[model samples]
Target: MRNKKQRIAAMCAVLAKNPNKLYSLNYFQEMFSAAKSSISEDAAVIKQAFEDVGIGRIETVAGAHGGIRYIPSMPQAARVLLLKELTEKMTDTSRILPGGYMYIADLFCTPYYVDGMAQIMAEWFVGARADFIVTVETKGIPLAMSVARILNLPLAIARRESKLTDGSVFSINYLSGSSRRLQTMSLSKRMIREGTRALVIDDFIAGGGTVKAICDMLGEFMIEVVGIAAAIVNRYPQKKRISGYRAIFELEELSETKIEISAC
Candidate 1:
């Protein structure tokens, strides 16, 4: 039989791996071969530890169907630190492309940065009770997928091309904020249900045209956009096409030989 400490550690590992998933006390009691009282005590310890370390949150739901679930959250201090580190790394002038765009494909592909950024973004919309996480195709999918996993929500990707395999698709044309060109994005009719709440996430936002177009498409399905977020927001244009969105980093300045970034 596992000792009390061993049981607690094992339970903590399970909860951490499955964020926002409910686990009944009885389930733990049977798994650990312990009494309900002992299981509760073990959970309490794990909860306290998580709180003290500021890693995340352990919520205890009461009632017959109630149990425990871990909510992935990063403390403000940790969030700021992570954004700061990312800002420093991204400020390297070499990352700036000829089109005045900063290269961040590597960061989105890296699990360390993706997970950190997703956790911070997910925390922002936890209270919004979003039904689905939505993002544009290509770059935003990775970060949006991570956020969906953390929040235990489904992810829907809007594609640049509407494939016939997708069946009936809803398409929209919006001006690209940065490129100043009209672009089309589409989503399958079956991808999301009406009257649902969606949280929009993107890897980068410039004039915010892409995200705004995404929101407009969701609106066609009667899906409400609860929140919008991005890993980086360009400081230029002074005004974005969309409002009330949050970002981890702000691109303060960018040039072929110079780049400046700051944590938002």
Candidate 2:
């Protein structure tokens, strides 16, 4: 016998834990021992409160099979603030590595930064309705995994070395724009389901060769790449092989003990 306020609080907690999961009105009604109309009212109140605080939104489905689901979407202003914080972190001079490469491994290692990246990317690709997330091995795994967790989608990784132990794997070779050399990338055959739409993600894109190679591999499995995302994109001399990808930060300039970056 939960009261009105108690029921509403419970509903918000449940929805927050299970974002994108559909829950029938009857399900909540039985759990709370409340009427359908009462449950709906509780949801409405929670929905408005969530929207007002920039937490997310509650969606109601009308059909017999439909019910309600919570979407963990962030507002534009919050997203912009997050990117601004990241830009300041990227401008640190100590993070610059040899060969003019900026090291951002520290940022990716933190849950706060990675989770914020996931939220921003989820907001960006919400309309795309991507089925799953794809990324190359090593640095991109954190961002890819975070996005997959937030979006409730599976993640597939593309490895640079083909694993014979994992059975038959698909491999492809592409020209690395930075090194100006050919590089081979591979992935497990069973990772991605055929005919599914994929969103590709990467940590940094200098010339987009790695992501381009991942897309080329996806073609073999008939997976439609809906969109691509990166945490950072470097401003380099050569043009990127792949286009239409979004990033959180752009490397505007790099010099000895100097680094410049801005939000993308």
Candidate 3:
């Protein structure tokens, strides 16, 4: 018999990892070996916790695939609160590096903070009423998945290099921050229907090439792009100010080795 908080945490964990998955109460029944009624109680507690915290959503689907799924949702307060926290952490000077880049990746991966970051970005997508979440290959998948879960939409990744995917969209391009030659790519034309209002997300943004390409690709489908979110924005020689919404702007480079941070 798990205690109140423990039970709620456990159930919430399941839903967080498996958002958009139709979970069965029966699955919870077997996993915890508690009475169905008791599991029901735990679920209700966890569901409301999810909503009250503005982390995401809790939905019931009725039957199979019909348990508790954490769907993405928007509540303004949650986003504001999280951005504040991000700003605070970035205040530490040690987080900065040379060449006007900031080091907040460690904090981003921290189990202590990643969840909060994930929730806020998800809310941004929801607030924009975006149809789905989009990001370039690598580094941004975590944030994308979090928001995708919140929105109950799909998480589509653009590959840096072509994979086994038969129909892929490929663009030869120079990365924004790093002039190093790179490939900006995605799945075939068959994938990614036209006219999706995608919310672009990333771990950080120094140069805007990837974002620009993502916007351009979305254009192919006649999809409207709502906006973009990053865990941190390192304002280097090139300032990145996207339209419609100002970024949370979590971090900045004071010098090659020094950094500064601000919250939303």
Check candidate 2 and list the clashing pairs.
none
Q: Candidate 2 residues 160-200, lDDT tens each?
A: 88787757788898898889898888787888778889999
Candidate 3 residue-wise lDDT, 8-30, digit = tens: 67777877777666678888777
- How do all models score by TM-score? 0.95, 0.93, 0.65
Off by over 4 Å in 3: 1-17, 20-91, 127-131, 164-167, 172-187, 236-242
| Candidate number achieving the greatest lDDT relative to the actual structure | 1
Looking at candidate 3, what is the lDDT of residue 245? Answer: 37
Candidate 2 Cα misplacement greater than 4 A, ranges: none
Using lDDT as the yardstick, the better of models 2 and 3 is: 2
Show where candidate 1 strays beyond 4 Å: 75-77
Shift of residue 152 alpha carbon in model 1, Å: 0.8
**The 10-residue segment with the lowest total lDDT in model 3:** 237-246
Tell me, by TM-score, which candidate is best: 1
